[model samples]
Target chain A: MALEAEVWSDIKPIPLDDGPDPLAPIAYDAEYSEAMGYFRAISQRDERSERALKLTERIVEYNPAHYTIWHYRQQILFSLNKNLNEELDFVKEQIESNPKNYQLWHHRQVLVEKLMDASCELPFINEILNDDAKNYHAWTYRQWIIRTFNLWENELDFVNKLLDKDVRNNSAWNQRYFTLFFNPTKPTEEFLTQEIEYVIEKIKMAPNNISPWNYIKGIIAKSNKDIGILEELCKEIEKQDIISPHAIGCLVDIYESRARKGSATDKEEGIRICTLLAEKHDAIRKKYWEYRKVILTSL
Target chain B: MPTEKEFVRDKHISYLKRGLTLLPKQYASNDTNRMTLAFFCLSGLDLLGALESEIPEERRKTWIDWIYAQQILPDERNPEINEKICGFRGSPFSGLPFDPNGSRESRLPFDAANLAMTYTALTSLLILGDDLSRVNRSSIINSLKYLQKDDGSFTQTYQGMESDMRFLYCAVVISYILNDFSGINIEKAIDYIKNSQSYDFGIGQGPGEESHGGSTYCAISSLYMLNKLDEGLLSKEKTLFWLISRQESGFQGRANKPPDTCYSFWIGASLKILDKLELINYEQNHNFLMQTQAKFGGFAKLIDNYPDVMHTYLGIAGLSLMNEPRFLELDPAINISKKAKENLLNNCAFHKQK
Candidate 1:
């Protein structure tokens, strides 16, 4: 790309700019200088440039809080013909400096995908997932990576590990459903039972969460292989709800859907449920409208 | 006894007051994301005729100063790149300099010409009842011209980002509010909005994208501002039909999406704009919104969730549109403080030069 003209006048780098300190500089507010240096370097490079990378390293080393600089650095590195390993190391350095930056964490996942494409074996993804099991980006990206690599066979174990770490991750719950429903290679019924039981336990512990309820709803909707198990799950929903009003409508929708599919509830039963719901919750009058339709249609 | 209108006024006042109270005292400097919310809360109050007893002028002035300071200047050319006309940074990121004009700032080029911010800033100033005399309209016009992409859709800024009807609407609002259209390539932009309308009669984020309630509002509202509402671009029957269809008790922004409280204003306002709001059962819609009200006196995206300022204000605004007996009258044009808009119109007429 043809470069735009330089509009800025050069000013002295400030009194604190005691030339580049070679030793791990105790402290340096080199944000402005480093940022300018990176911009200047990128402006000149016809192809991918390493000069911007070097400046980024210096910038991050001196001022770790400069997150935008890191983002800029990532862009520069990604654009450059840098190897995947180099990109990974650069991101690792950034994450180590500022682990709380969700954008960087997301970028790390992007880097991993690129690395995987390059056929580079890396355990960094597992390490990050293990560190923060609830990290939505990490879980989502891992799933993407697994799906791309056609590694659904090992996904059961991967999910087990994730749940072992954090049982309450909604992203994990979603992942489990995705794997169970969409995975070409399904796990054994016993393994599925255990996972569902664990999910049930988690739900019992925290009934307010919509994810577990949604997960249960998804599980019941897909497979009618075990009617007894489905009955038990329905019983659990009725008895165990912590009374989160938001979850009530979602739960009702699931039940209504099940009723429509002829999962046990007859047309009369569905109408009774809708009538009861209409009387009980004024909030979901719109939702009951659907149940009313289902009852009318069934009749 | 308060009249129904007075009750609505009280509700609006209480809602806006709660929104203001929820604002964190100190946000990150670059965090201009809340500027619109701040403008709406303050301006919304002013419009509701409830601002004076609530937010004082001295505090409002301070907010005005802080918002204006966020405007990136055109004169301070980046030492490395001069052609880059300085624009408002949404929020000062970690590496960006505190100085309004500083070199080596890690600026999101996407904010290079934020039509939304420009509109908000202008609207905010107008809402605060500031004279248009001091605003640098020429610089804004110049920056705005650059944000328009060749495809007719406006990039949020000069840097390549999401281009859609939203920004196009923003550009129109900014230009129109400033009383200047020189900044925008109007023909191309109108074409973009036209192309963005889905077969469903709702506006999507862009062409081939899913239609959303918010984007639909933007598209329709922009057309309304541009004096193109009745044009062949949007058929009244189809537009009204699509807008009315959004109501399932309350309104959802799109197909298969759960109703959010903000959509009550967004899609509701769109229906009103189309003069088809009567298609919705107003009592049902009002009841649905009332259910989403948090026990603590603010509205959430839905009931049983924590209340937020945006949803709270929007819910009230939605109710206001329904002619709910208790809220203040709204001026949708600038979405300005209706009171401020009135004040401005009165002042303009009072000082008529002719």
Candidate 2:
């Protein structure tokens, strides 16, 4: 269209003297000016037009991190009813270019949820996760896809694959908790028991790793009822955890909970451990530990 | 990585100076978020001591007028009806007309002020030496009543948007700058920040989400601004542990995440607020930040990443936290240079002067 040509008219190569870069022989003054002009033109153009849709493709390719453009891209997609699978593939290419760009993942979500089924998304998400196990944006979008598709059965296996690769991947641990809380059908007592055992085993493998410790706390919070298994595990780990007091932290929490119920048998023992943790491992927060110790002693 | 561990001050100044004009590439994508970039460039220039010499006070006045010209205030007489749409929109790209002395009747259907934009707009004005006498303080505060959810977190506007740590920070800063927390339920905002703490102790955008550097900064900075830093943080030791451990040479936003440039500000500034900034490895942090500086000008989010105005400002702000000589002293809690902070408190209170 003549519009694209008109948009590119004032564009000239940026002289090194005028531009920010001296190392680059290739100047982007022309491309950037044209892109901005096209963007402005598209903003003023009819949203449902093929011209606006084409301009978005160019703009997005040039700057995938732009959230506002991506929002407009969504409007174009909805207005044009672009081919669903083709749109997914287009976004997939962009995702490969900048896996960390939140806007790209957001666009992918809008596309998949609006036009396509998410059953095919898990594998693609897995590929991205394998490259960067802690790609927070991918992890978040993956959870969204799972919830949208009701792919709960595939989730445990997915988490297992991730956890097997890195026990310290907090993103994966967070995902496990997400799957559990949103499991739709309440997780049976037997399932939770197994999950608690799973976390305990992980803690035994790396008692110091913080993610599993958090998962333990998450499961406990969701249970809404005290579990004897977690209590027994906390006691056992408390004796074994020497360099750090993660296990002791768990026991201190449980003991305080029991004290709140007026059934605290280990109040004195809990005080002893808080004293040690405060004195030793987590000295950075010694003031906090000291406070906890005082409260436990008073109880 | 660049072998020389230099801040590339001159290149960055030129990069920031060019910010008043059309940016090089891809930044046009941020055409709508221009105010945020405006804050970064102006403040970045201010930090470099180039603000007055390069961008004169007269030019700054125009920029200030441009910012105020974007305000969408109440109709004054129709405060109840017009209050719902108060706050700054990110840019004038909404096809809204620009008027130097804000026109209340300029309100259109989608014309609303964004919390993020309102935030940057105020900071930019103060940085450029504008006394905020023109700001519609009550209307903006009135709008916050609707924008804040029962959960205490705030969406960017009244109509509806995602309420999270980002907006919460913006809202708190807006109130702080206005010197009034009356519009917010400070207790609820405190509760939201407390609840957003992930089990591992770092703060997230919402409850039960993965802790991130950006959100952690937002949550911590908000609490500091609110003066609830002590009570709002759930587990100080765990939070400190998580924040401190984020640094490996440079800092990562989350666990198992690769180190990036901007986290130096997000995580670095968080540490500054917590009084643990000295614990960071300076040589490592400095070299890592130096690597992200492009050969020409500005800083990028990562090594080999395209330089942008936001990261450039943050990278400079982050280094300024370390008492980097080339940059001005930063008051990390407020995210401005000490000079700008002084100017904000001194000159902008012209209402008090009269």
Candidate 3:
């Protein structure tokens, strides 16, 4: 293989200068510097040719987080009208290696948008999420793909599969909420009831899991439904020999909301649960529980 | 498996000093973000109250000069294009000849300023006691308008990178440092932050994204800088509850995530900003951080993990929040020492007249 300088022998490499008072300069690998040197020289020349595109690949391999390089690559792809399918493959490989890289995801989004095809993204993102379920970039990219491609058909099933694997995966729970409620049309009452039931069952599986509790509350809030809708479920979880602090916390929120509307008895119940949480069950956040208690008592 | 029972002050200071001088080869990946790394080391030392004692005065001056060299000012020849790119590049990665005086005749393509780098560069300069004499304040502020999107999020660069809470925080900090909000639409940015609050009440990187500890810090801090912290959150009480629940031992970025050292600062600072710092179990938080303390120096993300500059800086800052007497008081919103913030106020030109 020809060296980067030799491959771009026609262009003079702009050598990096660390200046007289350089601060914490990295001891860059010789190959990396040589590639970047040629990149700088060609990029300055406004060269958006095939060789420049190839140089970007080498530089990106060395550092995928370089947004400028990625931007240049996008420009070259558009200027050269290069095979975006092959470009997608290249980006997939980069994402596989660096799933958390923001630039890689953005580049992929640009390519998929330009291509106007997102058929391959779901499986690609699913594969990545399989490795790290809570990978933020993957989930966010997945959401974008789902929305852009209108691939909401089977998303609920996908999210359920993830939740089945790890019921505590907050990303999966968030995805479920997004799939069900984040559309042009609001969720129907029947659909909202089904989601609530689904979440309650998941909550039963792991009474301490906060994701489902949050999801159920999200459904109630988004629908503008009564918080009291979950009172029975909260009571059922609270009656268990080993009580869930979240369940009791839910009870406190429910009663507190009612108390705000001038129910004196609900205010007393809210304060009682807050006392229980502050003194026992969730003593780690004693102050927060006490604060809740104070707010309810004042109401 | 013996663990450090207290904040290893001297070891951490040594670690930051080494970070300032010569980073490990693995950090070459961070070559473009050298400014952020430098900020971590410099600010970490400042947080430990070791900046003056550890780094000599002349060396500190050189470091400040070196950081200023990375500033990307407007090119006289290409005013329109250069206006959007004027701020600070992370480092001299563009291979431009070093002009310590910053007298570059022409701006190069792809030598764009990153929002995060600009924020760190400014804070690093402040930490090093540099006056704002050399910063092209207007050009940087001019660049911010182009960076802000229609939805109120700010991208990392004019070249268009990921727009999220992270870059928005950087833009807000840059504006805060320059003491100007004219470049960005404050109302739109505030709306973007409000929209990013997840159903769980913790903020996310963007709308529909999961609430993360890091993004929560960015969102909360941005709001605090904008003077909108009280009204910006979707539900202040629920946001506080979500943040409070992050403390299992050290703080996790999200529910069910394992405790990490960096979130101790991320979530800890958010709590401090919300005036819920007293709610933290300081003893447990300190104990968890101690477990992640490397025997050699610095704090790792978790027990037995290798330490990096970012985590080390944040780890020290986290301990400082708990009123650890060995550390200096931290200004949580900016993730810098209170002394450094005061230096910005008293020394920088923007705040000097005020």
Candidate 4:
């Protein structure tokens, strides 16, 4: 992928120096080394020409994780006043190949910010999420786009769709919270109650799923509501013979909070749940449950 | 039924030695991060107690020289222009000429230092038993000021890289090793770390990001190095509970995520740093790590997954934290052998003053 020999004839490529003794030297492909050598020379000269842009594209194709090359490519795109729409298209292709690359996401952000248009971001990120629901970079970038462009109106619906598809999608649950609470208006008491109800329904669908449980806890904490609200629901679930570890874990937290607030009855309840978790339900974290029991007993 | 496996000490040593000599073609994309790769091998060997017996003294000296060569020393002519760019590049990928003696006249335009690379390079030098007399401490400290964003998070470099909890950890580690806090705005940084605490009570890469074991380690370790672990966390008990809950036979980066071998160190080391290492179910954790141990030489991310250098190092470090007698003791906060940390304390000039 090195530049045509005659195109950069005037420049001498700068070879990489690995000092006297290089450790763990990667046997790079010949194409990569040649392109990098010329790239080093072009970058040294601070070139912002079309040739430099082409060189960057070649290097980026080889390694999309190169932040320096992406930075330089952005500068070239700006200095040359190249068609940014075309650049966006190029970035879209790169992102499709390297969905987890932070550099590609950052490059896309720079391009979108400069274009002053976030219209294409949501659908594009949705497509990426459809492939891998928990792509962290895609979710974070989607959040940034939403916050920056005031695209919060449909975010909850998008999160709902994702949750309907996969109830265990923690990223989607986090987004639901972000869309509701991180927006401009503060969440009202009615809205908090509705969110708690929504999470409780999701929890009933899958009692062991921790995402909804965490979501309900977050909603309660945000409203400064008491954890006691979930006590009756836990008891009802247990009455139905559903022995969910997450439900029990939540009960332990609820009781632990009340116990710490000087409720002796809640302390005993917390110790009982901790024992149940240690002996029967969740033996994997037996030590953690035992530790919880010790704290409760001490209280 | 699965049979428990013994720690493959010899195989791991061979795996690390192979990485130190020549990496496979798949690592070509990691050419820019050669320093980090080298750190994984050298530090892994150090933890395995093979540094003295496996690598000769002369070879170690050469490595020390090579790491010193990566240092981005300030341009004496225009110190102000080069001030914020002083630290270590990951490699000579920027095409700087070989200058093991560091007598270069001018700094190149693209030869900027990265915070992660600087942290790894400094630790590598220490692991190789160098005195670090040649490190440009002031320049690096000055660069940290530039790297820190207004939000108190740090970018990897001054050239506008992605800022996150990982880079924040690197910045803190660099300052901790240099024995200077002037470069960091402690209050703002602590605020940033505090804000990164997710509702699950685990720390994330940034505010509103999902709680992850790796970022949790970085965030907690940064707070520990800053002398604010107890005060900095939103809720110590909840955070510890979240961390302990990650151990579903083995550790997962996040809830509902499949168990990965590396989180054994990420979460396990975080627990160790919090002085709650004993809380982990050691036998279960050991059994999980045994499942991930590759038959050849390294540990994989999951059972039957391919072995790689990073996981190999972390898996062994996780065992070391559990007080596994076969491996050297690790300083969980720094992710290096306790012996190497002792070397830093006794010999490095920064500690000499203390």
Candidate 5:
């Protein structure tokens, strides 16, 4: 009689999966009773620690595409917090199963970031960027982390990597230029010269972006003590966007800085270059006068 | 180039109106708030040339009565600050019986002179063509006296928040508009403003805060009002140069913020106040303002955006400064009615002996 009762208790009102018809597929009322009994048994058992996970897994088997159940299963595992490696594995599996889901991808990233810990965070972010070259979120997150850590070398490397993928990425290009301006470490002339050359190469490919032109002007103004790169960048800028006030102002700045530094050759060249640019670019005339005022007063 | 006077007037009138709303009677702040909003909105209308036939006399009288009711008496019993002057509160939140004295049995912490409210209150009275004969002048001065700090900055209320150049400028404008300097310590306030100027020549909110366009205008405008527009505080040339440098086709408030609708009145007005607005490219700034105008006849935060009242007014003010065709003429100083300003001047001369 006990064996018969146990068999009756096991009979679910709703089919769990494809097993046997089992008495013409128990009625919905009986199915509800059996599900309730199963839930009660799991709750009563002291060692059924993974019971929720199992339930979620079974539900997924019936509906493989149920993201909600998959979410619940992940949450239960995470809340238990007993097994991090297992948690990571599960996240990775979800990503593998649903690679197109940006949310899942972000969750995988969070797990990866956690697993790497603080000391290895930057390198891990770079590794992810290396895998997916067009990951804007990853790139931005890496930049933010680098900023907090003040990791100048890592930031420069990140800029180089981004440029290698697409030099015309305006945000990346702008960041590269801003790094020169805002970096805690002062840039040496040699470093800036090399940077100007690299950007010039990119500008050759895409001439419409006014950012590189503006940056080249800043470099010339700051380092007009060395006339070589400044002269080249100035000539290149004149051909690109002569109407950009920022570009023209930079020309004025270079001339004024050179005159102040007593670089006679650069000063003469600066005035001539600025005058020519100012003639063509009406917007920058005020900047020319400002620079002229400074130079005249200094003289 | 749009004149700074035109820019400030148009923008001030326009944005001031945009910020106004006739809250349904159920949502209305109270009789006092109704007065305050009336002052702001009506004053805004008066400045905007849209005031005729709309402001009813009885409604104006009610606002005046409610505003006058917020005045405090000068006596030692009420140890609370701002106890002796007439100023406006933001709203009647505590529902405590309206005490003009700012001292009542159940008065909450909110009972005091709010800087924005006081400015609006005085201006509104003037806009209604009131001679300000009923304003408790002595108590108002005493209230302002308590509102100022040793650092020369004023708080919005006696209950302090951040001490700022904005409030200090407001105090100066209030004093200037009222033709009364009995309330503020001019030297300390000027010193605070001078200290707040960043290396970039733009004024910040306070020491160590980032330079902003709005504060820059406030500092300069206040200095002009105080008759302290000399080389001793902010060198005229350097401040003007900084003001001129803010124009990047459209005006921006700080080092890196993209140009927006508001800064044109701010920096643009400062340059105008300094008589140096001609240094900027008027056509470009005007073009930028015109482009940002909304399709529905309002202005937005930026070009190709939805229009709101604040930006709409600011955009119009910016254009007005340039003396844009079809825009009304404006007073560069104080940015109120040239008609009202003339009236104010006439009143001042009438009372010159005092």
Candidate 6:
């Protein structure tokens, strides 16, 4: 017996230790079974009719990931000319109930796309991210909102606010980079300069945080800027405290870049630092540093 | 966190086995992830060294048949059209034809195969001792071409959905399991993996994304399976350093992220493939994972939480990597029992000879 409705009882939260919860608290096991049996019988018919749609709605209320229910609901929506705004409200509740379900996210996407507007999406994403800043589904859906709706104008500010709340939120950093990368005007040299300064300031505030350091490195590598900035930054960080692995790693990148341009002095220093890194600080990657040694010497 | 240190293998086995027959209420939301749930049980039991005895004889046959029934074979009647979308859907949620031998031409709109399910379904079949002779390898390989984007990352399907490391890993797995890489653009795929390496040396979903333990595993495991682990990798020491540091009582997927049950497998398996599994603090990880075990059975995302299928399977896999007693050896690269991997390899060789 699954879910039935021969009698009424107080609805209660199902036990955490189990699965396939009843749609609602029922009077008897037979009642739970009867209701679920009714839902399944109607579902198997797979009709696009009103009764079928209502059955799916009830079943999906219990299990949103029963994606066939969502499919039929969508079909029934179009057929019945249901109020989409009301449907949107219904999806919001489902998403809140089970935010991790992939079907709920996809269904929302279809609804938003059909509406041809993303005004509520930014706020919706903002609300969801507020629940869990690094929720991958929320972030992916946010990205989709930006891409489909051309909402890039506010992305930089969005990322900045999130970063301010938690500097270590790497998802926000990635969003910052994505926002910059996809800017319609194309990130210019001046913009890159500003971007690099923004990242360096963040790095100076928290040198141990790797994401911002990587953001600066990305900006530098993309801009083909003089590696001297990293050298200066590394020196400044050394002044603050013993250099971090990220700083040393950036120095290695700079020297390797220099060595690639055939600076014999830089090449020797690269091999020497790599040897130090191999032997000491970054010993976890000893093999890689050793490989770098062989490559630098051969060069 | 727990008073006892003994691994509750029996409780976990019961939890997974019970799930197969009657899913608990907590998992009602994951109705579509039923295939993944099955993978957890089959693989979990295999890891426990209890698969053969725990699964009833009738169930083994029925599970294999049910999985095959989910496969997306090309329509015999409209080969030209259905050929383009051949793979396995995640579940019977599509309400399509369920035939191991029935016509593949259901003409259902959402009858296409899902990449994650395809990966899990094949692995589950192998765990169940299915020879995979009935798996439509050619159609799946052919369907992979449609999933790949111009940049070499793959979407979950051909419907222009989100593409990232998850599907990239799936595509690589499907290719490697079938012993054919022709459908994938190896060089481009390698480029995508390389680009995904963030400043911290961990891999992410795509270029410029945040590094995550799961994506790092996918990226590393994909490259290893493709024979390009070293060549495509960047910042090796940084990546290794980052991975080794993830172990703070089990493992976390990223910096500042709390240790979770699944990362123990994702990061541990990555370290194993990198030949640095020995670097982790075994006692600490063991204690952490033990803390996450549910009283009734199974492992949760973190200590003192409800257990779920994904985390429980991975928790066992992670412990297996540590060679936890009574658990079977895990072939870390593909997250299967070493015995299952041998079967797959032998199967591949047998097919090659033909």
TM-score of every prediction relative to native: 0.55, 0.75, 0.97, 0.98, 0.56, 0.81
The DockQ of each candidate is 0.03, 0.15, 0.72, 0.75, 0.02, 0.18
lDDT of 3 by residue, A1-299 (tens): 34645556687777888776567677777777888888888888788998888888878777888888889999999999899999999999998998888889999999998999987888898899989999999988888888787888888889888988999999899898788777656677898888788888999999999999888888889888898988998878767765799999999989998999999999998888899999998988888899888889888
- Report the lDDT tens digits of candidate 5 across residue range A146-216: 55556667666777778777654544554565466556787897887787787677655655444455445
Candidate with top DockQ is 4
Tens digit per residue, CA lDDT, model 5, B1-354: 454322344444444443443332222212223334445355446645765455467655655554544444344555354363336554332233444334333233234556666776666656666666665555666678877888899876654433578788878877887778889998898888887764445666664344577888888888888888783245565466456656667987754346898787888788788776766777778777866765445567787887654466556566667676545555555655566666566664323556
Global Cα RMSD, each model: 12.2, 6.5, 1.8, 1.4, 17.4, 6.0
How does each model score on lDDT? 0.58, 0.75, 0.87, 0.88, 0.56, 0.76
Give stretches of model 3 more than 4 Å off: A1-6, B1-4
Off by over 4 Å in 2: A1-132, A144-153, A181-210, A213-299, B1-6, B20-22, B75-85, B102-112, B149-152, B157-162, B182-188, B291-297, B303-307, B325-327, B349-354
lDDT of 4 by residue, B1-354 (tens): 667888889999999999998888778767778889999999999998899899999999998889888888877777886787788888888877877755244466676889989999999999999988999888899889999999999999888977999999999999998889899999999999998998889988888888999999999999999999888998998899889989888899988899899999999999999999888889999999998999898999999999998899889888889988868999988888888898889999988964
lDDT, residue B287, candidate 1: 76
The top-ranked prediction according to TM-score is 4
Model 4 lDDT tens row, A1-299: 44698988998988888866688888777777888898899888789998999888888777777888888888899999999999989999988988998889999999999999998889999889999999999988998898899998888898899999999998888888788878997778888888889889999999988888887888888789998899888888898899899889989989999999999999999999899999999988888899899999999
DockQ value of candidate 4: 0.75
Best by lDDT: 4
TM-score of chain A of 6: 0.82
**lDDT tens digits, residue span B54-168, model 3:** 8889989888888878888887777785787888889888767777655345467777888999999999988988887899899899999999999999998889787889989
Q: Which of the predicted structures, 2 or 4, would earn the higher TM-score when compared with the native?
A: 4
- Model 2 lDDT at residue A176: 81
lDDT tens digits by residue: candidate 2, A178-270: 777766877888888788888889988887776787678768666765734467766676677456456667777777766656755667766
Candidate 2 overall lDDT versus native: 0.75
> Which residue pairs show backbone clashes in model 2?
B87-B113, B88-B113, B88-B114, B89-B113, B89-B114
TM-score of chain A of each: 0.57, 0.82, 0.94, 0.97, 0.43, 0.82
Report the CAPRI category for model 3: medium
List native contact recovery per candidate, as a fraction of 1.
0.00, 0.14, 0.66, 0.69, 0.00, 0.18
User: Model 6 captures what fraction of native contacts?
Assistant: 0.18
